[model samples]
Target: MKLSSGTIRLIIPAASLALLLAAVFYMQPRAMSYTGLNLLFNLAIPIALATIAQMLIMSINDLDLSMGTFVSFCACVAATVLQTSPLLGALIFIGAIAVYAGMGMLIHVRDLPSIVVTLGMSFVWGGLAVLLLPSPGGTAPTWARAIMTAKPPLVPMAIIASILIAAVTHYIVMRSSFGVLMRGTGGNDRSVERAGWSVIGIRAATYALAGLFAIFAGIALVGLTTSADANIALRYTLLSIAGVILGGGEFVGGKVSPIGAVIGALTLTLAGSFLSFMRISPDWQIGAQGAILIVVLALRLALNRLEKREKHQ
Candidate 1:
C-alpha cells in the first residue's frame, strides 16, 4: 500500500535521522553508548530551539532574517549582563521580545516585507552583540552551566530537552486555539480579519513568542559553550530554516510540524557528527552538509510525488 503525502512527510525526517545515525554508529562504533550519544547530540539542543523559533515565524508565512544575529545578541547578554546582573538581563530580554513584536506590527501595518524588516534588524542586533562582547570572553552564568552539564537518568539532557520542546511546541502550534488563529493569519489574513480578530495583534504575539524561543536558544548555546561570541550563532539563520523545511514545513503555507522540526534539528547535529567521524575537513563541513541536505530533500520530494500520484489513482 502506498502512503499518503502527509504520512510521507512525517516519515521522511525520521528515516533520514535513522540512516544518518546508523552511518554515524558505523563510522564510530563507540558512539553507540549513552555517553557517546550525549556527546554527539549536546549541541543540538540549542539548534532545535532555534528551529522552533523559525517555525513560529514560518507559521505566519514570514521569514526572520534576524534570527541568527538576534540569537547572538542574546548569547552575548546572557554571558555578560545576565551573569553579572540577572535583573538587568531579564529586563533587556523582555525589551528585545517587545522589539520583535513591534517589528511584526510594523511589517503588517506598513505592508512591508518581513524579510526586509528582519534583515535591517539583523544588522542592529549584530551591532549590539559586538558592543556587548567585542572579544568573545564573557562567561556563562553558573546556573546555566550547571544545567547544561547535568546528566539525567534514562537519557541525556539533550534528548530529553528536544523531546520536551517537541511536545510543548506540538501542543502550542497544533492544538491550541490561539495557535489556530496565528496559523490562520498566515494562511489567510483577510479571513482572520473578517472574523473580527486583529491580524496585527496575532502577528505581533507570534513574533514575540518566536523571540522568546530564540532567547532560549541563545542561552542554551552559551550554557553549552561556557562563553559567548558576537558571531557565535551567525550560522543558525540558514540552519534553522533548513531544519524547518527538512521537518516538512512549507515556506508559504501555514503547514508545519513541531515534532518533525525537532527531529530534523537532531538529524542535522548527527550529520555534523557523522562527518567528523568520517574525518572530513572542518572547512568543507558546511558545504558537505548542504549536499547531504539536498539529497535528503530530493528523496523526500520524489516520494511525495509518488504518494500524490497514488492518491489520484
Candidate 2:
C-alpha cells in the first residue's frame, strides 16, 4: 500500500515522537510514569510555542531571525515589570507586538530581505534585554509560576498544554478564512492583491500574531525557570526552525503544519532528555539534535522523490 503525501508528512513526526518515547522508556522504565513524563516534557511548552511563532513567520514565506531575542526580551519584561507592575508589563508587551507589525510593514514597503531585517533586529532586541535585566535575575509573576506548575490528574500538564496550543493554532492558521488569505499572500502576493486583498495588512497581522505567540513562549519559559536571562531563549531560534522543517514545513512555499510542529518540538525535547539520561555531555546535545533533524529531513526528501516517481509511472 502506498501512503499519500499528507499521510507521509504526518507519519514522520508521529513516528519520530514514538521512537523517542520508546528509547527513553527502554533506557529507563521509570520514565514511563506520570512524574517521569512530566519531568521529561516540562520544558516542551515553551519550545512548542516558539515553534508555532516560527511557523507563523514561515506561513508567510518569511523568517524571523529575531524570534529568540524577542522571546528573551519578553521574558525579561515578564520577570521584572510583570512581576512588579502588571499594567506596565502589559503595555510593553503590546508595544512589542506593534513593533513586530511595524517590521512587517517596513519589510513590505522597502522590499527588504526578511532575513537581513530580522537579523539586525535580533541585536537590538538582545541589547534591550541586557539593559532591562543586566544580569540573570528577575522573578516570574505568581500567575506565571502557577500556570507552569499546575498539575492535573491522569496526564501531564505539558502534554495537555501542547495539545491545546496545537489545536488552537491549527484551527486559526489552517482552518480559518483569514488563514487562507495569509497563506495565499505568501504563496502569491500578486494574486492576493489582484483579488482585492491587502497583502501588506495580512503580512503585518501575521507578524503581530507571531509576536503574540513569542510572548507566550517567553512567559512560559520564565514560569518554568522562575527567573529571566537575556540569553535564556537564544537557542530557540534554531530549534524552532528545525522543528518547523522536521514537521513538514517548506521555507518558501507557505506550507506548515501546526500539529506536526508541536509534535516535532516535543520529539526534539524528548531526544534531548534521552541524551541527558544517557549521561551525555551537554555540549553534545545540540549536535545530536542536528543529527536527528538531518536524518528526518533526508527521509522526508527520499519519500518525496518516491512519491513523484510513482505519480509519473
Candidate 3:
C-alpha cells in the first residue's frame, strides 16, 4: 500500500502509541484485560488534559512553565476548598483563569519573554499550592470521585475522555475562524493586527482557555488520587512539553495536532507502565524519560525534513 507523506505523518503518532502499548502488554500479559487496561490508562486523563493545555499555550509560540505548579494549586483547591465551599472554590478557579489571561496581556504589552514570565509565575503558584496544603492531605469532592470512577458499558473512561477532548479541541483549534486568528496572531502578529483583529484580546482569550484546561487537568488528577499535595503535578511540566513535541507540534509557527497530542499522552502513559513493569527505579525512570524525549525530538526533526523534501519534489 502506497501512502502519501501526509498520510504517513497522520499515522505516525498512532503507530507509535500502538507499538508502545503492545510492548507494555507484552511485558505484562495480565494487563491485556479491560480492568487492567483501565488501571493502566485511567491516570492518563489528567496527563492528556495537561498536554492539551500546554499545546494551547504553545500554539502561540509560547511556553507555560507555570502549568505544573498552577495545576498543583488547582488540585489543592479542588480537594479542600471545592469540597467545603463550592461557590468560593469556583470563584477561585475563575480568578486563576483571569490571572492567566491578564498575564498574556501583561507579556504582550511589556514585550517580555513568556518563558521568563511563566517561570516566575511558577514560583508564585508553587507558593500558593504549598499554603493551600501544608501537610499534603485533603479529600476530593464526592462528585469528582464519582465522575472519575465512572465506567461505561464497553470503553474505559480514560479513552472516552481523551477522545472527547481531542475531537472538541481539534474542531475549535483547527477548523473555526477564531482558531485562524489565534494562529495568525502567533505566525504574523503584524498581519493579524492589520486585519482589524484585537491581538491582545485574542491572546488573553487563548491564555484563558489554556488556564481552564489546566484546571480540568488538576481536578482530574485530584479525582484519581482522591487527595491533594503541594507537588502533585510537578513532573507534568516536562511531560506536557514532551507530549506536545511527540504529537507533531512545533515550538513555533502555531502548528499543532490535538489528536496527535492525545496519542502522545497515551504513549507516555504506556511507556511509564513499561518502565514500571521492568522494575526501573524512579530516578532512573526520570532519566529514561528525558532520553526518550530527546529521541522523539530528533525523530520529529527528521520527519520534518522528509516532509519538506517531498514538498520540494
Candidate 4:
C-alpha cells in the first residue's frame, strides 16, 4: 500500500518510539523502573534546546557552529555567579547569552558568512570559558541542583517545560509575521531583500534566537550536572544538528517542526539509552549515531530529487 507523506512521517516517529520502549523493556526492566524516566528527561531537554537553537539559525539560511562553545561558556559563567547567588547567576547567564547574540548579529550585519564567523566565535567563546573556569569543576547552587534533578509527581516538570518551550516557539514561528518573514528569508535571502526587507536584520534575529536557545541548553546542563565545565557544550554541536535534520528540518532549509525536532531528540536519547542498557560500548554509539545521520541525510537528498523530478515532469 502506498503511503502519503504525512503518513510516512507519522510512521517514522511512532515506529522509532515503539522500538525504543521495546529495547528498554527488554534490556533494563529493573533499572528502568527507577531512573528510566529521569534519564529520558535528562536527554530530551538538552537535545530539544540544542535542536531549537540550530533550527532558529537555519531559519535564516545560517548555522551556529558556536553553539557548543556558547553553551559551555554560559554554563561556566553561571556557575561562577551561582557561587555568589543562584538568582544572580541566572541573570548573568541571560546577559551572557545576549552578549553572544549581539556578537552574532554584528557578524551578520557585517556580511560575514555565518558558518565562518560562528566557527571563529566558537573558539573565542571556548577561550573565554577556559579563562573563566579553566576546567569543569565548579559547584552549582543547591537550588539549581534541586530544580534539575527533582521529578515531580503527576507531571514531569522537565518534560512539561520542554513542551511549553517547544509550543511557544512553534506558535511564534508558525503564527507570527516574523515567522512568515523568516521562512521567506530562509528560502531565499536575495529575493527577500529585493522585496524591501532587511535581510541583515532577519539574519541577526535568527542568530539571536539561536544564541538564546543555546543558553537554555547550557542552563539545563548545569542543572543536570550541578557543575560547569568548558567542554560541556562540545558534543551538542553535532547532536543538535543531527536531531534537526532527522526531524524533517531540511525539507525547507531548516524551517522544521519544533515538535518533530523534539521527537527526533527523544529518539536519539532513546537510542543511546537502549545501547547503553544493552551493554553496548560507548564507541559503538558514536558510530551508530553517525550511521543514522548518514541514512537520514541520504533520504533527505533522495526526497529532494524526487520532488524536483516531479516538478519537471
Cα lDDT of model 3 by residue, 1-313, tens digit: 6676535555767777787788878888998877888998898999999999999889888999988999999999999999899999999999999999999999889989999999999999999999999978999999999989999878888878989999999898888988888888878888899989999999998999999999999999999999999999998998898888788877898877788888888888877887888899988997777776677667767877887887789
- Note the Cα lDDT for every prediction shown: 0.92, 0.91, 0.88, 0.73
lDDT computed for candidate 2: 0.91
Cα lDDT tens digits for candidate 2, 112-136: 9999999999999999999999999
- Sort by TM-score, best first: 1, 2, 3, 4
Give per-residue lDDT, candidate 1, residue 233.
98
Scanning candidate 3 in windows of ten residues, the lowest lDDT window is: 1-10
> For model 4, how does the per-residue alpha-carbon lDDT over 1-313 read when each residue is reduced to its tens digit?
6555544544455456567678788776764554556666575787788888888777676777887788888778767776667677777766766766676567667877778888998899899899989866887766667777777785666667677867888886767888878888878877888999987777667666777788777777777888888998788888787777676676345356676677677777777777777687897987876775676556666766765676588
Q: Which 10-residue window of candidate 1 scores lowest in summed lDDT?
A: 1-10
Off by over 4 Å in 3: 1-8, 281-283
What is the TM-score of candidate 1?
Answer: 0.97
Ranking by lDDT: 1, 2, 3, 4
Q: What's the TM-score of every candidate structure?
A: 0.97, 0.97, 0.95, 0.84
Model 1: per-residue lDDT, tens digit, 173-291?
98999899988987999999999999999999999999999999999999999999999999899989999999988898788889989988998888888888989999999889999
In candidate 2, the residue pairs with backbone N, CA or C atoms under 3 Å apart (3 or more residues apart, or in different chains) clash, namely none
| Poorest 10 consecutive residues by lDDT, candidate 2 | 2-11
